[model samples]
Target: MNPTAPHDTPADLSVAAMTERFRAGDLTPVEVLDAVRARVEACEPTLNALWWSDLDRQGRAQAAARASAERWQAGEALGPLDGVPVTVKENIAVEGVPMPGGHAAGDPPTATADAPITARLREGGAVLVGATVMPDWGMLSSGVSSRHGITRSPLDPSLTTGGSSSGAGAAAAAGYGPVHIGSDIGGSIRLPGTWLGLATLKPSFGRVPLDAPYLGRCAGPLARRTEDVLAAMQVIGRSDPRDFSALPAYTGDYTRPLSDGGADVRGLRIGVHTDAGCGEGTDPHVASVVRATADALSDAGAEVVEIAPFMDEGLLADVDRFWRVRSWADFSALDLEDQRRILPHVARWCMAGADVPAVELMRCYHSIQRMRATTVAATVDYDFVLSPVAPMAAFPAEQPMPYTDPSLPMQHIGFTVPYNMSEQPASSVHAGFTPDGRTVAVQVAGRRFDDAGVLALSERIEEIAAVPAPVRIVGA
Candidate 1:
């Protein structure tokens, strides 16, 4: 297959389009699965995104496809993603498959049952190709793991792919799958999407169900087009009886002419904050790219307001405390040696949790909850808040970790982590590229449960400042 030639291969087709073709009898599920398998084999050496690839599992998927094809022929089909092949983040469970959670100490744990999100996708008739790679315990920003090596960016192999949803981003960008399901507690979904020039949605917390073993963080899809993300959300967003936090809400038919009503940014209020208290060390190039994006939005008729005085500096500290408590709770079952053998940074993080006093941890937990409420209240007036996703563009892959610059005061937490603390929806859309040929992104944040509003605003901006396609890495 010519990499540059356009074909109706599963790798190049979006979820919505693939479903249409399968339903129209233009292509069979088995043929699409073969195309996807071939693409994965072609890209894996350069991208290093998959945690595991099972031919036997692919065979089983093919068998399921035959059944679906029969149903289609009989004019009795199922959900929107029928016959679509996709990948999931390693942290999410898939029954009978290994959930390594980015560790090398023992064999990947066999999930007793499918995670709620996984079950939803399967029920929708999507085939699980394999699990994508992530950071150890999904705590770090860089997508490097001792067990899986480093997942490289499809655009440039030497640069870091944003993580802990690194593999999801890489897989989607490389066209291994049109949709890659990933989770984000701190820019995990948005960061990589931005770097790879893809679209991602970090839906409002509790909009998607979070079953046992993984709570607090919500999972969503990363795709090349915004409509694909919306379609995936419709299928995944539903009230699950198993998830107590799940809410009853209506899912919109996102494909119905998003542009028929001429989306305009004229007079729409957009708040821009370049500093965000990252201190003077914020990369000048990143700041310039963000400002240019805001200017483009303004040119397209949006009212761009510069935020004054910034917000509470205490937000970052609150985020840190939240991380400590959550990490401790998540890692309690692991033995010390097993933790150490997984990933060094993750083991260090787990060890830090051992020193936190119970009283102090409880205090921090309460503090974070209060901060979240206050922050959400403060942003009620603005339709969207624009900020930088990362302080810099993709950095050298050999660095200990991206976003570790000591000069930047809030280097660890930065702009993305705070939104995670607030439990509000956020997205990182590709703003533009720098003169040095690196990708830069603008983050659009919305009020709690106002995910559609944020997405609407982003679609307008993306139209005005269309980001370029990923430049294939040389000599990968």
Candidate 2:
């Protein structure tokens, strides 16, 4: 034990705390890695959070840590994240790792080169541990994967961590590591992050360059603390020449607000959004949490206005239909027999789109443009908006979708997906926990391309409402 340092966090592990310890010569990268691995070993039996958890995977991280230790010893450490352990979503390509992507199927092809996000993280000297699991095609929100099995919540093993970014949430929640990289399309990152009680961001579209960039997809950070997320983002959220859609070379400062109070909430017009447009009515308890958060912000000298739900059922249906038809295009190319290899729920969900009329599908596509305009228009008047991350508490891990039936699975994303469609920056941070111990979180979303603005508000929310410092993990 390092007598001078003591346990730097509740779990005795955090990216920021661990890196500081390494700087003070109170800990070695290898020692921290071992501590994390030990907890992962204890947690994975119940969590099933990692796609690769073998000796070979450990060796790769072992090599990275040894090199980082040498650098720290010589006072040549790369940066804040050097030697900090992180896991990327399996979908993010890492050379030599087969990207199965949570589908039960034939041999998956190994990536010959790292994806842009993977390369940036590696270049920044953050130790890449094994990749975390996700749903096939990242289509499902819950963590029932045909290939990787169920990813249960660390807070309650009987409940889900929620996905498409399933394993990333589980790993971070279970104290498997400090930082986990996950992608957000719809609510892949934010939804699960809320359920996992993480500080997660779905940065503005193209804020973080992605090799497989899609309409709303972007890679972002998830961690127990906001500071750790900021540290990781500084390294990965940069313009990559490879990403054609990337934002102009990322020169924006995400941490300046925290240090200098640059984006203070004082006198800011913040929207308090209670309705999600079209989900199950917000649970009274969940509504209370959002109201309390908004009340806290109001107390912090922000002008809070009640924003009614601008999203309607037709808009959500149009968005859902468009995604289904898109998924059908991919599924149709697969062998008929091989199609059954994916999660049964996802298969059913996408199959409905196979017969969608070409005219209707085209109409659905047009609806996206309309929804984007509508979403931005509704929230643009305010500096930022506050809402519940999910309409209710965490759901059972055994299910594939929440509230709605599998055939129409976009129900739970009403609050999250709009930001994606609008290309806005949205963050999910801890609000409070339910009586049953499930965590609830509040969403702070800003206008398009206002990632730093969103993050600044998120930091303030953490201060006024309080984000669990050194996050209290389950069964720790």
Candidate 3:
């Protein structure tokens, strides 16, 4: 799309590379957006990564790109990412777009104003290409949805791209654009990042403000390269008045660590979490990739050690129970006719909470508190912890869950959910591939409020591991 590299290989499609070409007069934002939109159109028939809303996304994005080109020609460009193409999650409100939450339940109304994240993207001069699709209410990690249908991975059409952030992952892997923003409550961003072999960050709970922030749901960037994610965080990481849950605006810089040569790791203690303590144990191949990644960190002058499993079936069960009750409450409030439109598995999963007693719900809440405290204390000694993004690789796109049952829905999230409850910053980078070509990735977790440090370390690990990038598309 950028004309330097073929559409399949996205090396030149990265934000940093594209903007550099624009500055040298070798390209124009209009040209790039046109080419990008074309590529997306070509891939859409198979990937199904974008959501079609009533919003005039194309006209608006084209206008923004034209303005950026004029600014560059007049030497008044806004910033490095002035004309970068970005796709927002459909759930996040953009002016005049309905917040469907990926469901066909109601006559969803349009937003009168942009969400904080969307507003920041506009202020930073990013062109809003369109919105990406997600599973219903972001409840499942798989791509199947009642509203958007199944979003198969670009790398392997049979396998899922993983979700809540489903369409964003599919778009990134297919090179739709450099920035595809998504929300991560329990590894929604990083899970897909791993399955699709992309780079994504689920920053500290409040690093990027959300219009309707929840306990551990934070909005962040997803791209093929960590550099692009950093380019995006530079803009959306600002403070906003809308989210009462957000931390004070971030004052630290995210770019310096990369420019100044990543984080100094000579003395950093790194912990390797090889066992998740519940669910099907980590696949041998997945465990091996993680260990190799840790070895690379050890070779980089950091102290690496193994950490005992601090999680169990009970903790994961509690998380599932708490979320089920939350989902049930939301589903109950919807109009009775609308509730019937939910995906069958989701309906079955959430409705289980309808019969729970108040005492059971309180116990689930208390178990979450225990998990938070335990997760925080377990990693206190290490500057960061390295683990697999999941216990296994991607599952079939048509499947509703890895376990394929609503009652045991979240067995795959054990390695990721604790961090959400603990409010820690975590990221996923491509590690390697399984023997069968399924993508494998590792998660990097850092102390609370150390969002920048986590990213800097993640970049360094990416360099050290140097895993081969998955092909642009596999089995297409």
Candidate 4:
């Protein structure tokens, strides 16, 4: 910890805190980035959370940091995220950074220009320090992979960080700067956010643009502070001509509601779904934390009601089946040698998709449509629906999924995946901790286009039951 540190150490500085320091002329962008770089350097060897960095981009980051510092000195900040340091998940394309999507095939091509989200971040003055790791093509929920290796949780090095958006979650929890951009198709953002005990928003579909061409994928913000997530979202959610799905006009300043202390849930109806609606039981400790969170919301004057499961058991299996088949189709286009480079699990999934008939795939789409309607209906009467983010907490880093019995198949993705299918706004907030120190997260989901309301409820929950500090990297 720094000798001049205030209430919190630099290692766990929040975006709001850092910006306040800058506004008071007490800190500079370079100083903040230097602290963040030190933290990343100290933790990188142990956590292996990052895939690549912008530091070696011909000194571009250096120039940008200097310019940001000068602006802070002159009281001419660019926007809400001015001088905020952030990390982008490796799957998101940044100009000059290779978006290999964690594939091990050699000689991946670098992105020619920044993805729409990255471009907005640059425009808002959030310094891009690096890119976090993910599984090959973001195929798995766990961080373990053949390409970037395993990404352990900063909370406990032995625990998996939870992926597809693995490194983004790990880095945010390890305090590699305040804000991070994560992509979620099937709970990629919220899963890691849950395991790492950070606040993450999987924005409603089309609330944020899709830079990389893919279905069911949306880029959203992840951060230790909900305020930062909101700030980052304001920038990244801006409409771009490139994205046909972009909202007609940006919903400016997501932090506005929270700033005015308007996120009160006194009259709000929040439904709690713990069984995951798939007939799967949540791990005891995980369920307890979520139940306790519900009680906390009740104490805060919100009407907490136990609700039946909103989704079917087959929802994620179908989604995965569709993705696996789609992934196989894409993999088949690769050369023989490149095909040989794919991860074993990824290949297995791809093969699983290969044999499925076109009619079955069409059935999968209809199922998803039904699932979306059911989820939307479930939340129609309630302001938000609360559930456990996952059936279990973080597991061993070496494993693929946190399944106790491999033969039984894993239903760990029960809660968050349905929200993805529904394309509604959902967030994972730190509910509490497990006996073993792993964090538990409660999912707060709202109707379509209610991204702001979802976040507002999360902020209220945050105020009522505060999240813990970032897990300090031992050596750092």
* Error of model 1, residue 77, in angstroms: 4.1
Off by over 4 Å in 4: 1-11, 56-58, 256-261, 404-410
Candidate 3 positional error at 265, Å: 2.5
CA lDDT of 65 in candidate 4? 76
Which pairs, if any, clash in model 2?
none
Ranked by TM-score from best down, the candidates are 3, 2, 4, 1
Colliding pairs, model 3: none
Residue-wise lDDT of candidate 4 within 390-416, one digit each (tens)? 888888888877764322323677788
Please state the error at residue 228 of candidate 2 in Å. 1.1
lDDT tens digits by residue: candidate 3, 1-476: 11243443322377888888778878888887776776676678888888852224458888898999988888787876788888889878899887788777887678789999999999989888888999888999988889888899988899999998999998888877789899988889999998999899998887788888887788899988788888888888888989898889788888666323556677888899889887768999999999999888888789998999888999998888888999999899988888999998999999988988999999998998899999999999998999998998999999877777788848888889999999998999888889999998899999998888888888888778877778766322
Q: For every candidate structure, what is the RMSD over all alpha carbons to the true structure, in angstroms?
A: 3.3, 2.8, 2.4, 2.6
Better of 1 and 3 by TM-score: 3
Give the least accurate 10-residue stretch of model 2, judged by summed lDDT.
1-10
Please state the error at residue 449 of candidate 4 in Å. Answer: 1.4
Per-residue CA lDDT of candidate 2, range 127-202, in tens?
8877899987788888888888888887778888888999998888777668899998898998887888888999
Off by over 4 Å in 3: 1-5, 8-12, 53-58, 258-264, 474-476
**Decreasing lDDT order of the candidates:** 3, 2, 4, 1
Give the range of the ten consecutive residues with the poorest summed lDDT in model 3: 1-10
Tell me how many clashing residue pairs each candidate has: 0, 0, 0, 1
